[model samples]
Target: MEPCPECGASMDPRSCDELFHALLALDHSRQAPWGPLHGVSVSCFLLQHPSRLPADDGAMAWALLHTYLEGGLDEVNQLVGQARRDNSHRVKGGPLRVVRDAPLPHRDASRSRFSVTIQDVAVDGTFPSSAFTERVKAWAAATVDAWSCGT
Candidate 1:
């Protein structure tokens, strides 16, 4: 396994269930501005790692899901721009593509807060068909639960 770019610790690619549970266990509130970016950076790193692709499809989905859930569209855009500019060695298919293709969460006009669901966005074509997956959908559902609980 290769060392994570955000943290020098070695990381192995995780399955969708593993990634979902791990993220759920984290105190994302403490992760703040940089924590979300760190996840994106790590996914990008795994995508570029010579060892293998590192199951980065799930990783990228997780990162993008959380970024949109927590920081909304602006933060997602910032991370996407960073990944595009910083990871020069990236190929055509990578986390950057996921970030670029994924839909940005929007605030519902009727609701004061951004209450839009992944399913709604996906059905409406805001989220590209390719980027919307079971894993990403699960993450978005979990995010909704977390937000409702005020955690």
Candidate 2:
């Protein structure tokens, strides 16, 4: 196995192929909404280029994830705003707020690798422990499987 230049994640030659297929699956599947995994996929695609690594993979991943989440929040906020304009009484929450802890980026230069953990997520000031968590996990698992199976 070789280390990915950008994130330093150890990857076999097949890893890139796997990543490519994963991206394709995400593109095709309606079940996979635009979110963290999309960000990760884009980052991986950019960083895993054979020619050069664009930036630290781990940092890029977190940055993309943050961007994706923020974009989602913006969409939700827009929807809520639209709802308020349409019918003031129909909207339940004034606005949905999403909050999450900063991702912790860990890297080992010697191994040319990096990883991150998303600590928590909250929607409307409440932890949706199951739904949100499960979505992320399922997306990640699917991504891994997509690549591992060489599909």
Candidate 3:
């Protein structure tokens, strides 16, 4: 195995493959085949790459970033679901907000904006840093092309 120039560390293909699989598991799916890999995958990767411990600042930093991003995605989904529910509700509580362009007042006030202001609704939950939130939004938008919006 050749040394990774970035950190002067030998790159083990097996460990890299495991890391990739672990990353894939971070994506939310009802059929998440990877199950809970939080410590197991990290430990396995570190076992194969002894010189590259999981807690190494670089690796830990990436893990933190990954968790932050995953958390952000969950929040985005929650917001989207809240908006959907609010639209179906008989009263105000969730993501429903009044819009100036609407002709009807009651139901039109429940429409959600497909803009950054969607994050301003304050649905009661903590979030990652604003920078992480912005990155997650960008990631969602970019990946939308890869997902099917069909019935």
Candidate closest to the true structure, highest TM-score? 2
Q: What C-alpha lDDT, on a 0 to 100 scale, does residue 98 get in candidate 1?
A: 50
Candidate 3, residue 44: lDDT? 27
- Could you give the candidate ranking by lDDT, starting with the highest? 1, 2, 3
Candidate 1 lDDT by residue in tens digits, 1-151: 6544321323344332233334333324435333333344333223223133344434454456567666764777786777666566745544444544433222121212223222232333223334334334343544434333432
lDDT of 2 by residue, 1-151 (tens): 6654543444443344454554455445534343434444444444334233334433433344444345553543444454346455565665422233334233322222223212111222222334654544433333233322332
Per-residue lDDT of 10 in model 1:
32
Query: Which scores higher on TM-score, 1 or 3?
Result: 1
**lDDT per prediction?**
0.40, 0.39, 0.32
Q: List all candidate RMSDs to the true structure.
A: 16.3, 13.8, 19.0
User: Residue 114 of candidate 3: its Cα lDDT?
Assistant: 22
Where model 3 places Cα greater than 4 Å from the true spot, the runs are: 1-31, 54-151
What local lDDT does model 3 show for residue 2?
A: 68
Candidate 3 local lDDT, 42-148, one digit each (tens): 33233223356433322332332233245543543444454456668575665443221212212112222122211221112222233433433343332221111
| Decoy 1 TM-score against native | 0.29
TM-score for candidate 2: 0.33
Model 2 regions lying over 4 Å from their true place: 33-40, 43-64, 69-113, 116-151
